[model samples]
Structures are given as C-alpha cells and as structure tokens.
Target: MSNNGGNGGGSVLATFEAGTQGWSGTSLAGGPWSTTAWSSQGSRSLQGDITMSAGSQHYLLKSGSTNFTGYTKLRATVKGASWGSYGSGLGVKLFVKHGSSYAWKDSGWVTISAGGLANLTLDLAGVNLADIKEYGIQFIGASNASGTTAVYVDNVVLGN
Candidate 1:
C-alpha cells in the first residue's frame, strides 16, 4: 500500500468512486444525475440541481475539520447530459468558512458535449483550507435560459 501522509492527520479526507457514493436530486425528465448511479437528493430545479454524489451537500469532507495548512488539492471528474446545450455546462465552487458563513472562493466551469470526461484540479496553496467547511458543485444552464439539465460527477478526491 502507498503511504500518503499529511498534516491533516495522515487520513484520507474523502473519496468518491463511480457508481458508488454520490448525491443526486429529484428525478427530472431525462436528468443525468437522476438516471446515473449517484446518490439521490430531493432538490430539483428548472436550472439544474446541485447534488452531492458522495459526501454531504452542505458540508464537504474537510468541513469542520482542522484547517489544512499544507499543500492540498481538489480533484474531480465530470460530465454533462443531453438537454441540448442548455444544461451542458457545469461548475464547481470551492468555499472557505468566514465567521459563521461559507464564502465562494474559487470556481471552475466545464462543458460536456458528445459525452466525454473532463478532469479538474484546484490548488489550495494560498486559500485557508482549514476554514473550509463546505463546498459545492453546481450545474449551470445555457445562458439566458431556464430549464432542467442533467450532469454526472465522480471521482472526487481530496489530498495533500
């Protein structure tokens, strides 16, 4: 076994395997997150849903844990569903807690046309990883349109 240790107690923060632990929202008409094998949530919207495929939706893996003050990274694999180009764009947001609220610190957007995989990595060198208790992944609809779309998210791993 590989020995991966770090300042966060040398423990794995969170790991999301495909067809395994993840979150989804209400089954929309041909919704990608609804049909896939991700975990299910009840929240659905006309502009896509933000479901946690593995961990808690409101709180990420490192939430409430000691602030990660060392080298850290956030990685994930994502794909979008067919809702025309309306729901093909998705975004990931990183948040850090300030006082009693979480704030959006970083965000990355990806488009999945023709159904392919996109890998995303965010470096958390300067950000206060320790204060981050919650993070979010959101599916963005086509600009200037309002409707439901589907997306697939998997392989969310955080490490040092």
Candidate 2:
C-alpha cells in the first residue's frame, strides 16, 4: 500500500501478480525466487531460499529489459528469516543494471531482521531508466558459514 511516483507519478513495474513472468535466478548455493505466497497487499511475494554449508552467494535476478523509462527510485518490502538464531542479520544486495552497456549500479547491503519486515529504497539518480536491462537481489554471507536462510519480498515498484 504505497505510491511510487515516476514520469508524472506512480508507475507500475513487476507486480508478480501472475507469476514471475520474466524473472530469473542464478544461485551458487541457494534456490530460486518463486511466487508461492501472497504477501502484503494481497499479492504473491517473491521468495528466495539460501543454504550455505560453506559459503553463500545467491541471487534473484530480473533481466530481459524493462520500461522504467522515467522512474527515479526503486522500492520493495523485504523480510528475512533464520537470522535471529544465527546471531547475524541478513543482507539483501540490490543491483541496478544499465541497459545496453551491461554495467551495474550496486547498492550496499540492506540489513533485515529475522522474520521482520522492512521497506527499502534505492535511489536511481543518474541511472538510465529506459535503458535498464536487469535488476537483481543478492543474498550473501560471511565466509564458511553453515546455515539455511530466506528472504521474502512483495510489491517491488519503480518510482520517481
């Protein structure tokens, strides 16, 4: 239940209302992003499962071009689990891909609590909206850890 204003105001991006229509994942030690549960706003939340017996490097990436032509910011509702028991929080990395060039604008880690929800915002200042080729979320951990974790997301919106 938020308003993302872009172009003139409020542009709708991937709602995941009908599955991850064009989304994909690349994981080294984790599962994929699946639309299995309806999260906030009564829509399916994108879920990511990570297991790191030695280390963790998982991804929930979206590619194949986007129409964020006039957006100024990106937002999402993010939550993490299995963190409290581990005594370490979870970090969700945000990747903003610049179109044809294939370069990326990366944000520092967004820390989320164990089973707690948080709102995240990544400023798209100086980013080429119309030329964006991909977007990604990376789940990472310190070296040689042993655990299984997860992050849940809903209402990913690009805004002004």
TM-scores, all candidates, are 0.52, 0.78
TM-score, predicted candidate 1 vs. hidden true structure: 0.52
> What is residue 87's positional error in candidate 1, in angstroms?
7.0
How do the residues 93-152 of candidate 2 rate in per-residue lDDT, one tens digit apiece? 677888678877766776554576666677888788778888867666544445666666
Local accuracy of candidate 1 as per-residue lDDT tens digits, 1-160? 1223232333333333222233333323432222333321222211223332222122222235345555477655455445443333333343334234564554455544524446666666666666765543544334433444345554444656
Maximum-TM-score candidate: 2
Which candidate wins on lDDT?
A: 2
Q: Residue 28 in candidate 1 has what lDDT?
A: 35
lDDT scores of the candidates, listed in order: 0.41, 0.64
Clashes within 3 Å, all models in order: 11, 3
